[model samples]
Target: MEFPDGLVADTFARTWEMLLPSGTPGTAGLPARKLALAGPGLPDPGPAADIVLVPTHPQTGKAWQPPSGTAAVVPLSAEVWLHLAFPRDRLLVPATGGLPDGVLRDDPPPLHPAAPFRPDARIFFGTLARLPAVREPWLRTLHDHARHRFPHSFR
Candidate 1:
């Protein structure tokens, strides 16, 4: 079968509209050496690098992705996530209170094609495991002391 001689669907990169004036951490930049033709078309996938290739407006100096050609690169992440039975979304515990800096750790490049993961920590305090323990001291406790020693949740 033959199809129409035209583009069925088209997408352009405009991520530049969302980038900060000054680049933030975890952001990759489009290499400065590339010869870009400033016009409406997909962005050129500059040189390959482990970091992200954040495309920006040549004049505005902000993140932008042309909507048709460049196919701006949006790297997922260079960090490894923890491995546990808990859902990934449910365990959104970044080191800082905000995102892109939570419970994640900088992961070295993987030699194999697999998702980055770790077994550094896991939720072990469960209902059965928290049955007052086999033995305990009769002494009193302090604020959050019980909560820490015997967490009510695996969180």
Candidate 2:
């Protein structure tokens, strides 16, 4: 079944809320432009960039690390790492210093016989492979939804 954009965003937001710490602060809004890969070996979306949201810790006011293997191993700040994950509803500040739930998982049999990656990431990469032009529209929809849902965060 084809999932509507609203349903997909809502599902993602709900999943993010469940994974975030109880009092974690929301992100500092979506990035101004698409995110650039911070490392050399990561898959490059080129012009079809993805929206990345930078989340901050509520208490310490620090940024959380990106879950390992979710994306490329970048040397950017922790906030940048958080942004790449795109937990739009709230900051996915890990409660136990481990990977957040439902973010990354074992690769499906089609992609890799034995490996791990985020399913969403795989879909994203797959789309980029098939139609490079699809990236902007996909990210635009997400950014628009986020701007509508959380107007305060954008400013």
lDDT at 121, model 1? 24
What CA RMSD would you report for each candidate? 25.0, 18.0
RMSD of 2: 18.0
**Candidate 1: count of backbone clashes, pairs at least 3 residues apart or interchain:** 22
lDDT digits (tens) for residues 64-153 of candidate 1: 443333433432111211111111334334545654534454554334425433212222223323546413321112112333544434
Task: State in Å the error of residue 139, model 1.
Answer: 51
lDDT of 1: 0.29
**Candidate 2 lDDT by residue in tens digits, 1-155:** 11124423433445333322331323333233333332322444434444322344555655433433343222435443343433253434445675666777354322212532223534433444575443565434443444454455434
* Clashing residue pairs, backbone N/CA/C < 3 A, model 2: 53-83
Per-model TM-score, in order, reads 0.13, 0.20
Candidate 1 Cα errors over 4 Å, as ranges = 1-43, 46-52, 55-61, 66-72, 75-154
Clashing pairs counted in every model:
22, 1
